[model samples]
Target chain A: MRRMLKLLPIRFLSAALIYLVAGITLGTLDALGYGSFKSVHSHLLAGAFFTLVIMGSMYQLLPTIIGAELKHRSLAEFQFILANLGFISLAYSFLSNYSFLKVAGLIAFISFILFAFEIFATALSVKDFYRRSLAIWFFLAAVVYLVVGSAYALAGVLGITSFSAARHAHILTLGFVAMTNFGGLYELFPMLSLKKLHSRRLGEVHFFIANIAAIGMFLGFPERGNLFILSSLLFLAGFYLFAYNLTRTYFSKSHGPEVEMDISARFMAYALAFGVAGVTAGFTSATLGFPGSFTHVHLILTGWVGLTIVGAMYHIVPMLTWLEKYSTKVGQEGVPLIQDLYNKPLAKALFITLNTTLALFAFSSLLPALSIFAVPLAIAFLVFAVEMLLVLGR
Target chain B: METLDVRGLPHSERPQLILKKLEELGELEILVEVKPVPVITMLESKGYTCEAEQSQGVWRVKIRKKQG
Candidate 1:
């Protein structure tokens, strides 16, 4: 059981790094006037990279955070296998074999069901309602989005239903990816800063508004109508609420020396800024029929989701690795601090370069001549991969 | 039973302080503002027993060396 707890997150994070590289490679190629591989790229990053990281983090943290034993512990390893296979198959279908689409979709759908069931069961076992943090609620909601969005997408893929690809993307992106990140930030920001949430009540309100906006936008997309406009407004409102809540939580007065924001939290702060920018761009693109749709998507996916995962992994990887390697030896001998497990200078470098690359990439979307930024973006991802792998080695 | 108040300590300093205190005292209680899940997990993994309870929004965790 201990070994499973130790190894599961590492396995998932290692896999996410692989997918990140592949996804970024394809994205860079697309930017260089190569054949359009947008579908494959999106699947690799969103379906594989994001999903793997979220699954791994949840498996590791949920038990600790919610004060409940994870239900179906043994099945989590099997679920990981299924998730990887399903995503690989899906990526293959997008790249080459259309016949593999249905099979891939089924496999991935089953994996999603297993994940949702496991998490829901674990959460339900938490008899104490107050112990069930707002983060758990976000996680539960994300898995719901995962199952429903994937089913809808599979139906569309199988020609059983006609729907806009954008709608399916929004379901997974806004509902699943964004919600998971929100939950993570909610949990992590407080823990890292050693502060309680600024407004639990406001967070609850944000959750409902975000969910309604996600569903409303899904129902309203491909048509710039009242529903779409209202949903867009709601979406912005939710984002602002989240931003304000977390900002206050982190910046709230500490009785002792002010808790300095570490590099990890700094990354998250920048990620939230990017999230605000992304949603604003998304609203403009939807309401005004803007030409730079790609800008909004890139900002959200790369700037928002990508940075959040990276930031989280910085803290999580070191802590997990420290727990696995040093926890048992604490009193027996001197043990290295969790912060000492990772290279600080490399982390700082990755932070600066990754954000710079994201800014350049966003600009590149507007000015085609600036597409040269893709090379730096790819390099930044490579640096991230290397930095994370190095942490594992330490 | 010594009571170690770790409310304002940096996260990196908490574990070491707890372990050193445990090594010196054999058993102690910690007062923390947060749940201190990681500390509890580490202590248990290191062959210590821990029980935590909350009162007045503060967590009081008792840690003892496990008896053979």
Candidate 2:
């Protein structure tokens, strides 16, 4: 049961590493006095942390979800080491402003490309609609976007692009990372909640539309306002449909949904809505410019992306660990459910406080008066750390 | 004596797993209609009621009576 706990550190390692790096970077960038080191952190979070976690979960997820023997276990085994090494080098490069990160990115890019090829071959080998469709849709979209986005960033690194390098960062973060994770969510979440999904049609709809929107917006930015607007609308619409279906799944189930779902799934639903708000604001707020851009990234990262990852962790951790065996055993024998393993009150407080702090951080002019917001957000992380430790049984 | 076809088995799953699960629970001789990968070819050769076929990643199996 506890074997899956190893996957925990791998996932949380990235999460914590991201913030730790971001905090240092932000402290360094405080001289600017407006936005922090978000521009840099966006790339790090999307490329390194998000990339690592998604790959890890997919290893855990693809086989279980699709009921297929992993195509090459040896390759899967090596992928973890290769990816993390590349990520570490890339992060170091970013911090040191070294050319080596490009080399690291190249290594990581090769790993990703190979990973994508393996997933494609593995999926095509499957004979089931649910499994194959999910594998195909999931790996294909995730890999394609990630590859292109990474290639673009790598091009920037090679000094080929005329634009600011940050543009590539945006494409990688928003286009590749977010699109991939969100697509996986549609397949993963309903199963976690023990409810039937609304429609595979809607699933495909969300997948294609969001990808098209992201790709179109990326390619057409600054020159094609109409295209960007249309793309943003499609992205928002896809999210809305996804959230709606997830909500229905959680609520529709007769076997009262798990505490994990209650906390994570519902939070993610809010995050999706928050994402819509953030994107729409960016579309309309040329007055805000870069800040508006950061706002959108924050919403997707902290709101939608962060919420989903956290919620998914709660479910995936226990499911893979075989901890659910204890619950089912306890249930049949008239014992309590697995609620004892978690601290709900602490999480609730973190949710409320963190949500408020992020909102203030993004939408408010109160930084002058409420300059103390960082303390609470930091406190929220403290609480999160505690709960996370409890989940890990630390 | 006759074969009946069932629909709505999502188009991508392995037909054998479906058939096996159904065969485990149901009381009928497994008959093949159509499938991409048929599980038991010997049954088909014996002129058993079941047969399978595959089209566009979808498999359908049918069941009928033996010829005598």
Every model's DockQ, to 2 decimals? 0.50, 0.04
For residues A58-80, what per-residue lDDT tens digits would candidate 1 score against the true structure?
88778767766678977888888
Off by over 4 Å in 2: A1-40, A129-136, A160-166, A222-224, A247-261, A286-291, A323-339, A364-371, A382-386, B1-68
Whole-model lDDT per candidate? 0.84, 0.56
Best by TM-score: 1
Model 1 off-target regions past 4 Å?
A: A1-6
Q: Write the per-residue lDDT of candidate 2 for residues A1-394, one digit (tens) a residue.
A: 2533345334534354444445434533442365545434544556665776677666656654444546876675666667767777776776675658678878888887777766666665667634444434755677777778777767767778755454565576666667666666666555444455667777777777777877777866556467766776777677677667666765674333233445655566666666666666655553335455545655667666766666665555433332323322322354323344566787677778877876765543324444345556555655564465455542
Question: Residue A224 of model 1: what lDDT?
Answer: 55
Cα error, residue A20 of model 1, in Å, equals 0.9
